[model samples]
Target: MPRLLWPLLGLLLLAGCASNKERPELTEVDQYREASESLESRNYLTAIDQLKELEARFPYGDFAEQAALDLIYAQYRAVDYPATVVAAQRFMRNYPAHPRMDYALYMRGLANFNMEKGLFDNMVSSDKSSKDMGAAKDAFRDFERLVNRFPDSEYAPDARSRMVHIRNQLARQELHVARYYARRGAIIASINRAQYVVKHYQQTPAVPEALAIMAKGYQRLKQPELAEKSRDVLALNWPDSKFLDNDKQVDLAWWPDEDDGLLSLLTFDLL
Candidate 1:
């Protein structure tokens, strides 16, 4: 409130700001420790910044390698999938035989796995087959490579589980495409897509539906023999199939249909 004190107060505030701003940057070891601490504390942004600083200042050492791995994990925790993938791949490429290769590979798969849109989302969108499955496909291959190359790696089991999930999703995506083509009267394309699911994704939950689609599609194409063969497979594998019970009607009432309350019927069971 006093006029004479105002200049002094302003000077004090400016000095405080300068002190805060000019605080010494951490040394390489200190920066690496800080990044590790931040990662432990779940402060991903701070961890990422500190890791990047450590990497830039000390580019080739054990600490740098650890920092790079930390950076990938931090970016992933921060939901920066693309950055995480790039960092993981860089780590793998730079240190092909590093003891942590399993981690890098697993993180790469996880980054793309997290990037994929939901399965049912692809089902109802314009065209499931035409939709760019780049991320899903990439994730699947990444996991497959991990499982195949490092079967005993600590991360292999989880990678194998993810591969199974990706396989099912891919199969379901194909089935959704088959359904779309069938509805649009593209018999050959529909049959091909369905057969792809049954042949390539035999173990997936979508196989029975794929076979059923093939049966209905072949019948529509006027190939009774092929239809009967597909029908036999569908019946043998899934005697209780709803599609089997519905004959050639395509009993996929879960998807939108104008004849019913389309929005209400959307259950979105991807399988």
Candidate 2:
């Protein structure tokens, strides 16, 4: 063969092998099976690719819907929660009444739940400013939608539990903000944050702290009526609270101004 022709033939052979490697013809079921095996073997990224290929090749195949579903799960297994949420939502839009619709919705909520869960860790830390409640709020809405739409779905119970957790976390976050403001003598801001917890997260466990913060804030603001009202509500709800231990002591009903001396300021919180 001529030297030039030999080189051209080698190029053609490489192209042929590359094409075969790029798109080896596989049946939809075979492709899905490979994806499933990849998922089971913990090769989530590979599973996602294979599942996507299957879906593309067999848009109307018997395994197409399942491939799509599996892709969502694979994305989640890969710790790609954002992509998992997107995939899950797309599945729901494409198959609103699929037998696994509940599963997709649950995953959507799960993703947001994970995002919000980080706020809990940040909240417990000293840097209160690092707290981020946006994800928690989004998760709450997602779980709420799941509960409302699929009350009987197997995932409903878990979703409800997550929602409750998120609610309590949010209430605590509000209380945290209230405390931060209170420490800075921002009494009005402190009271507002505490009231938010009472109004929005009434079912949460943080209500007592909210009420207590409000009472203290009202007292510092020198609004005796509102402070007494807050204390009354707190007593009604939490009669055994430490804040009310000195309630009967009229002298201790309010703290003296900081200028009164270090002793007055020191005992202000206890009073």
Candidate 1's residue-wise lDDT over 1-271, tens digit each? 5997999999999999988896687778788888888999999999998888788888985698888889999999998999999999999988898998989999999999878556475457533344667897999889888988899999999999988877877888888788776655566887899889878998899888887777766776688999889888777777787776645333544332333322322433221
* lDDT by candidate, in order shown: 0.80, 0.77
Name the top lDDT candidate: 1
Q: What is the lDDT of candidate 1?
A: 0.80
**Which residue ranges in model 1 land beyond 4 Å of their true spot?**
1-21, 117-131, 246-271
Best-fitting candidate, scored by TM-score: 1
What lDDT tens digits, residue by residue, belong to model 2 across residues 1-271?
A: 5989999999999999988786658887788889999988999999998988887888889998888888888998787888988898899899988988888888888777665344366557533223787766777888888889889988889999988887888788887777756655567887899899989999787887788777777777789898888877888877776556755312223333444433433566444
| Model 2 spans > 4 angstroms off | 1-23, 116-130, 246-271
TM-score of each: 0.79, 0.79
